[model samples]
Target: MAPGTFSHPNSSSSSFILVGVPTLEAFPICLGILFCSAYVLALVGNSMVLLVIVLDESLRDPLHCFLAMLAAIDVLMVTSIVPKLLGVFWLNSNQIAHTACSVQMFFVHSTTSEESGVLLAMAFDRFVAICHPLRYRMILNRETIARICLAIVVRALLVMVPLTGMVTNLPYCRSLVVPHSYCEHMAVTSLACADPSPSRLYSVSMSSLIVGTDIAFIAVSYGMILRAVLGKESCRRAFSTCGCHICVLMLYYIPGMVSIYMQQFSRGVSVRAQVLLADLYLIVPPMLNPLIYSMRTRRIRKAMLNVLFPRKAHACHGGQ
Candidate 1:
C-alpha cells in the first residue's frame, strides 16, 4: 500500500475511487463512448506511426526517430489513464488500489515530461537542418541523438518520481474520491490530510521549469531558423519542414498550459471544465499527431501508404 492511504490503522489495503466527471455522471454512456473512440484512435494512429517508422528505411533519421519516441510516449500516456477511465465509466469500477493510483500518476506525469523533451529536441533538429544544413548530420548523429533520448528519460524520472513520491507519502485520511477522470496530481493532493502546499509548490515549479525552459529553447531555435531562411529561396522548404512540428507543438503545449494553470490558479473554472481540458490534453494530441504528420509530411505519408497499401504503392511507383 502507498504510505498513508490505508483505509484504517488495521486495514491491509486502501483504494481511491476515480469519479470521472461528477456533473456528467448521468451521461456515463456518452462519455464512455467518447473516451473509448478517442482511445482506440490514439492507439491505432500512434501504433501505425511506430510501425511505419520502424519498417521504412527512408525514415531512418533523427526527426522520425524523435517522432517515434513521441508516439511511444503518447501510447503510454493514454494507456495509463484511459483503461481505468473506461472502467470508471462503463463498469462503475472506479476503485483503484492506492499503489496503482500512485503508479498511474507517475506514468502520466513522466510521459508528459518526456513528450515535452522530445518536442524540444525536434525543434533543435529543425533548427540545425535549416540554419546549419551542412552540419546537421554531424551535429545530430546517432550517438548524440541516443544520448539526448537517454537524458530525456532520466530527467523525467528524476522529476516525476519525487513528485509522485511526495503525493504518496501524504496522509490521505480525507475522501479518496478523485473528482477528475484520472489521478491527477492536484486531484490526489486535494485528498491529503496534510498540508498539500509543498507538493503543489513542487509540482508547479517543476512544471513551469520544464515547460518554460523547453518553450524558450524552442522559440530561440525557431528564431534562428527564421533568421537563416529570411529572403532565401529555401524559405518555403524551411517552413514546410518545420510547419508540422510547430502544429504539433501548439497541439501539445496550448491545452496543457491551460489545463495546468487553470487547475492550479483559477477559482472560476468548474470541475467539469477542468476535467474536460485534462482529457483533451492527453487525448487530442495522440490522436492527431500521426494524422497531422501523415498529411503534412510527405515522407511519413508515403511510408504509411506503402505499409498500409503495399500493392497500390508498388503500382504507383511503377507508374512513375
Candidate 2:
C-alpha cells in the first residue's frame, strides 16, 4: 500500500494480540510437526544414553565418562530450546520475561562451552590410551578423570557467566520482538537501543578465547593420536571407536561453522535457514550420539539387548 493508504497487514495487526508468535499463517502445521519430531528424537535418544550409562557399573570408564558428559550437555542444550519452541509453535506463551531470557542465554552459552570442552577431553583420553597405552592407566586414572571433568565444568561456567551478565544488564527498550524461535544472544542484541559494541566485542572475544582454544586443543590431541595410531597394528580397532566420535563431532562442528559464518557474513540468509541450522546444532548431536555410542561399544550393545529382551530368553527356556 501507499504511505497514506490503508493496508490489510496493518488492519490485521491492529486486531491481534502478541501472546504467541507474530504470525503462523503459511505451513505452520508442517513446521509444528517437524519441531515436535526433532524434540522427541533428541529427548528420547539422549535419555537412552544417560539411562544405559547410569544403570550399568561395567560401563564405567574414562571414555564412557566423557561420553556421559557429552550426553548430559546435549540434554541441557536441547532442553534450553525445546520448551520455548513448543510454546512458540503450539501454546500461546510467547511472552518471555527479561530474567527468563537471561537465564536461557546463560545456560545455552555454558552448555556449548561444556560441549566443546568435553570433546577436547575425549580426544585427549583417546590419545593417551592409543599413544601411551603403557602409561594410560597412570595418566587417566579415575581421580584424574574426575579432576579433568571438574575443571571443564568450572572453566565453562567462568567463561559464560560474565558475558551473559553483561548482555543482561543492557537496556532493551527498543523492541520486545526476538526474531528467532528462542531467546538467543545475537537476536536479543539486535534489539538494544544503544550501540551494542561492547557486548558484541565481549561475545566474540569470549568465543575465540574459549571455543577456539577448545577446538585447538582437540585438533592437537587428535593429531598426536593419529600419528601414534597409524604406527600400530591395532589401528583399525582404535579408529573404529575414535573415528565414530570424531564424525559425530564433525557433524556438530560443521553446522556450527556454518552458523557462525552465516551469522557474521550472510545477512541475506533466511530466518528459516537460521532456525533450521540451530536445530541441527541440538537435534542431530543428541539423536546421533546414542546411535554411534551403542554401535561402537560391545558392553552397551549387550546391555541393551539384555534389558530389552529379557522375557524373550526366559520364554525360550520354558520352565526349565
Candidate 3:
C-alpha cells in the first residue's frame, strides 16, 4: 500500500507472501502483542508527561519548556507509526498506500532527526545551566527556543526529504509488500526492482552525518557539564539534578546506537527480533522518558499525584 512496498501478486495462494517476510506463525503472535504494548505505553506515557508539565503551574521553567517539546515530539513520533502498525499486525491489513507510505517515511525519519537536534539543545541547556547559571536565561531565551525548533524542523525535513525522493521516485514494478511493519527506509527501498544502491548509500551517508554529529555534539556538551559538575562544591546535588537527563540520555542514546548497528550488520538475527528491537528503539523511550524523567522533581511528583487523585487527596489533606 505504501509507495515503496512490494505487494503480494494474489492473496489466494498460500505460497504468496508479502515481500521478503514469512507469513506469520505462532511466534509472530507474540511479536504483534509486544508491538501493541509498546505503542500503548508510549502514547499513554508521553500524553501524561505533556499533561502534567503543561497543567501544573509549578513546572514552568525554560528547561521544562524544552522537555515538554521533547515529550510532544515523542508522542507525535510514536502515534504516527503505531496506528498503522496495529492495523497491519492486529487487523490483518498489511496494505499501505504509496502516498501514505511516503508520508509516513518522511515523518518517521524527520522525527528521528528532530529528536537528535532536541537532544543537542537539551544538552546545551544543561551545560549552560551547570556552567554559567547566571547567563542561562539570557543565552537560551524564548526567541532562541523558537529559532532552535524551527531550525530542527527545517534541517530534518531537508535531510530526510531527499531520501524520500529517492525512495518514492524509484520505479517499483512488482509486488508492493512492505517487509517491515512501518515504512522503514531500508525496507521500503529494498522493494524497488530497479537498483537501489544510490538511495541506500545516500540514506546511510545522511544517517551517519546526522546521528554521528548529534552524538558527538551531545558528548562534547555533556563532557563539559561533567567536568563542571565534578568540580562543584556539591557533586551529589549536581549529579542529583542531572540524574533524569542522564537516564533519558542513556535510554535514548544506547538503544538508538545499538539499533543503528543492528540495522547495518545484524544479518543472522530473525526479522521478528529486528522489528521488535526497532519498535523498542522508538517506543521504549517515549514511555520511559516521561515516567523516568518527570519523577525527578518533588513538585512534578506531587502534581502527578494530584492529577491522579485530586479530590481524595485534597479531602485527606483538609481532614488532616
Candidate 4:
C-alpha cells in the first residue's frame, strides 16, 4: 500500500477482526454470557410488546402504533450488533467480511436515526394529546402516523447509506482489528490508511444535527404541553401522561450523549469505559423500553397480561 492510496475500492474480499472491548479481553465468556442474556431479554420483551399490539385491536391507535415502531427498531438495532459481538466474545469468531461489516454498519446507524425520529414523533403525539386533546385524533390519525413513519425510514436511508458507503470504501491498509465490539463508523474509519477526517467530520456533524434537532423539537413540544396544562385541574394528569415519554427520552439520549463525548472529545476517558458505555447505550434501552411501557401504561399492561396469561386475564375479567 502506498502513502495516500487505498488498497482496493470496496475491499469486499477483506475481513476485519472484532475484538470485543480490548480492556475486557480476559473475560470474554463472562461478557458474552452477559450480552447474550441481555439480548434474549431484549428480544422477548420487545417481541411481547409487538405481539400484544398485534393481538389487541385497541392498540392500533396512534400511540400504540408509535410504540410498535419503536419496539421494531429496538429489535433491529440490537440484532445487528449483538450476534457479532457474541461471536467475538464466546466463539472467538471475530473475523467479519467487509460486506457483512458494511451491512451491520448500515443497520446500526440507520436504526438509531430511525429511533430518534420515532422518539421525536412520539413527543409530537404527546404534545397534541396534552395540548389539543379535542383534536388529537384529528391530527395524529392512522394515515398521518403512517406518513410520519415513512418519512423517518426515508430520512434514515438517505443519510445512512451514504455514510456507510463512504466509510466502507476507505482503504483499510492498516490493522483490520477493530478495537470496539461492532462496526462503529469511527472505529473502523480509524483503521483506514488514508485520512479519516472527512468521514469523521461528516458522521459527527450529521449525527449531531439529527439528534440535536430531534431534542430541540421534543423540548419545544413538551414546553408547549406544559404551558397548555399549567395550573389547570388536569395538570397532574397531563404530566403523568408525558412522564413515561420523558423517562424513555432520557434513557435513549443521556447515555448516547455520554458515549459520544467520551469517544470523541474526552482524552481522559478509558477505552474500556468508552466501549462499555457505547454498548450499553444501544443495548440497555431496548431491553428496558418495553418494561417501562408495560409498568407505566395501564392499557399496555392489561394487554400484555391478556396475551401472556390469558386464563388468569379471563378469570380476572370475569370476576370484575
Top-scoring candidate (TM-score): 1
For model 2, the stretches where C-alpha displacement exceeds 4 angstroms are 1-25, 311-320
In model 1, the runs with Cα more than 4 Å from the true position are 1-5, 8-13
Per-residue lDDT of model 4, residues 1-320, tens digit only? 63323344455347888889977899998998999999998999999999999999999878899999999999999999999899898889999988888899999889989999999999999888888889989999878988999999999999897788688667777678888999888788888987888878888888899999999999999999888889999999988888888999999999987887678778898878888999999999999999999998999999998998999999988999
Error of 4 at 282 (Å): 0.5
Pairs of residues at least 3 apart in sequence or in different chains that clash in candidate 4? none
Per-residue C-alpha lDDT of model 3 across residues 226-286, encoded as one tens digit per residue: 7877866867776787788778888877877677667666898777666656677887888
lDDT by residue (tens digit), candidate 1, 29-142:
899999999999999999999999999988989999999999999999999999999899999998898889889999999999999999999999998888888998999999
TM-scores of the models, in the order given: 0.97, 0.87, 0.87, 0.95
| Candidate ranking (lDDT, best to worst) | 1, 4, 3, 2
Q: Distance from true position, residue 285, model 4, in Å?
A: 0.4
lDDT of each: 0.92, 0.73, 0.75, 0.89
What are the per-residue Cα lDDT tens digits for candidate 2 across 222-294? 8887777786888888888687778877977778767755755588987667766765676677767878878
Better of 3 and 4 by TM-score: 4
Q: Model 1, 189: alpha-carbon shift in Å?
A: 0.8
Taking all chains together, the TM-score of candidate 2 against the true structure is 0.87
* Candidate with more favorable, higher TM-score: 1 or 2: 1
Candidate 4 overall lDDT versus native: 0.89
